[model samples]
Target: MTTSNWLLPEHLSDILPAEARRIEELRRAMLDLYRNCGFELVAPPLVEYTDSLFVGNSQDLKLQTNKLVDQLSGRTMGVRADMTSQVARIDAHLLNREGVARLCYCGSVLHARPSGLLADRELLQIGAEIYGYSGYEADLQIIQLALDSLALAGVQNTSLDLNHPGVSRALIEAAGLQEQAGEVLSLLKEKDVPGLRQLFEATTGVPDDIAAALIRLPSLYGDGNVLTEAASALPDLPGIRAALQALRTLVDALDATSVGIDLADVKGYDYHSGVSFAIFGRGWPDAIVRGGRYDNAGSSFGRARAATGFSLDLRKVSAGLAPAEPSRAVRAPWNSDPALGEKVRQLRQDGNVVVQFFPGTTQSIDEFVFDRELVSDNGQWVLKSTN
Candidate 1:
């Protein structure tokens, strides 16, 4: 036999029955929530042309997606890492309409990025997309869905970290530290305040003031009042200021207590032209839900419209919650006969689990498998319990 190691990298994992079933319940509950909000659900393929996949989300996902060549066409494709791009493409080409189309999706997604850079390469994302909608009302609807899902998942100690990408980009560029700011942000993302300050001090030739501002950015996280601090310190950075104002509006839109601020908490994508954020709760520093506005992503196709959505990572959500008890996977058809089926339904309605087998289908339900001699003169189905 060939030798192979059984160890798996931290990047990959398998969900045993107990965990998988819990995740399934969360997914179903999320979908039900989406449906109640009037959003229709659709599922896209796990694989799509690499060109098509990258076009909507952007070039960043290139290395993260697992690329392959389709057997029939031989054209290169990649296992989809996100569902947003595909949904955007569909809206552009298929809807071809003039009004907003609310679409939701749920599916398993694959990526090459390890769990550290993200939660897992193999992930499940369930969220909604609204096409042809640019107004803030659409934003409200999606946000409500996200809030509702968090409750359904039983997530606690949760805090909503909000930031406006538009403002962050504008601020960075305005400060004239666009390039180095990325590195500074990276250090801060790891919560490496010491490294961040050291990097700021070492990067000579950049003004000390800018370096100081960049270093100060990390500690700027917290509350509606934090905006005033960023505003005062980075007075010349209008890009950052405007971004904060938009954030201020979004925060004001919601009850101030419901959301929190993190001026330094940036997202992975530069395409988040407007507000961007991820949900974090106890046991999950990685986002349980992530979303932002992509106003120009669709322009790569043939249309331009603002869009934003957040997906609930059911796996991580379930991981953080208590392990639900295991349950049977397959259930018996009510019964072979119409009358028996009715009785089984009533039992199920009363929360009793029961399985029924058709009379002719190989001994009605595998109640037992044995030689014909096992049957007694008076026929009956019976088996000795393991107990």
Candidate 2:
């Protein structure tokens, strides 16, 4: 049997009318919120040279990117897997502002494969980034904006999970485990204390203090108390101390009930140079928002600047919300009468959805509920409520 023409590739699908409308509404609301907060919107192209696209990104991002050859220039190009780097390039080269820049963007990003078994290969990614600011204050603003974005979408009970890659990187480097950095990072993410002990035991020349601290990193998760516990449990390395202090600042500033500490989170360790965060809603298995500081990402772009931001897949967030309500609309007749035509135009101009039905046919769409109709009464057009 031949394949159906309508069949889509695995993990790829189209958004139907109802879902598309909801996603679009969310896109506008999020962008509006960002604009209200002084972030100017910028849209990067969907395709770009691989050299520029992959600059300052992590290996995982490279693997997620889909590459193709440009027939015009014979150069390699890539469909963006993430827009953060592109936005960073804009801040470094295009805008090139001296003091600070606030940018926001919303667009589709293609991934070589689904991030999870049930995830789609295409994502409607929306986020805001702040460049040229090094202080944790920038981080705080980004995090708050992320939370507000969720709140605007009616998501409640969101808990923010915070991590700093420097804490683990410091221990690993101090122990001279650069060669085994990948393995160490993996173990830290899994929080496999026994596995960590086994690796450290087999390896020679590892500092006992470093090994102990790395092993302790995984359990240092919980509420604000985790930070206090870490200060005494881990070594007094400057990097480690700095990481804890950053966490403390956020904890003291944010609502304590909605924050949690996870020092062993290695999710963005390679990409994020400072405190990274993931916001999870109640009953959701994955993070709804992911962002942090990556000051070194713009280095390859020829200008290094302080950067921090957070992004969320709009489609994913929309998927978790309740079904969108059908828009109330007025059904109008397709007629030659000037009065009827004028009335329909006024209704539509007044923010009413007026759908004109064909003279001899009827059509239906789930996107709209025809609650009212324009009827001719005594040669005068008037709106009649159907509900």
C-alpha TM-score for every candidate: 0.81, 0.97
Q: Candidate 2 — which residues are off by over 4 angstroms?
A: none
Give me candidate 1's TM-score against the actual structure.
Answer: 0.81
* Per-residue C-alpha lDDT of model 2 across residues 235-314, encoded as one tens digit per residue: 89999999999999989999888899999989987799899999999756699999999996888878999999999999
Position 291, candidate 1: lDDT: 76
Model 1 residue 359 CA deviation (Å) reads 14
What is residue 315's positional error in candidate 2, in angstroms?
0.3
The numbered model that scores best in lDDT is: 2
* Global Cα lDDT for candidate 1: 0.70
Pull out the clashing pairs in model 2.
Answer: none
Candidate 1 at residue 304, lDDT? 80
Kindly list the per-residue Cα lDDT of model 1 for residues 165-196, writing each as its tens digit.
65446545654666776575577566677896
Model 1 residue 330 distance off true place after TM-score fit, in angstroms? 13
How many clashes does the backbone of model 2 have? 0
lDDT of each: 0.70, 0.92
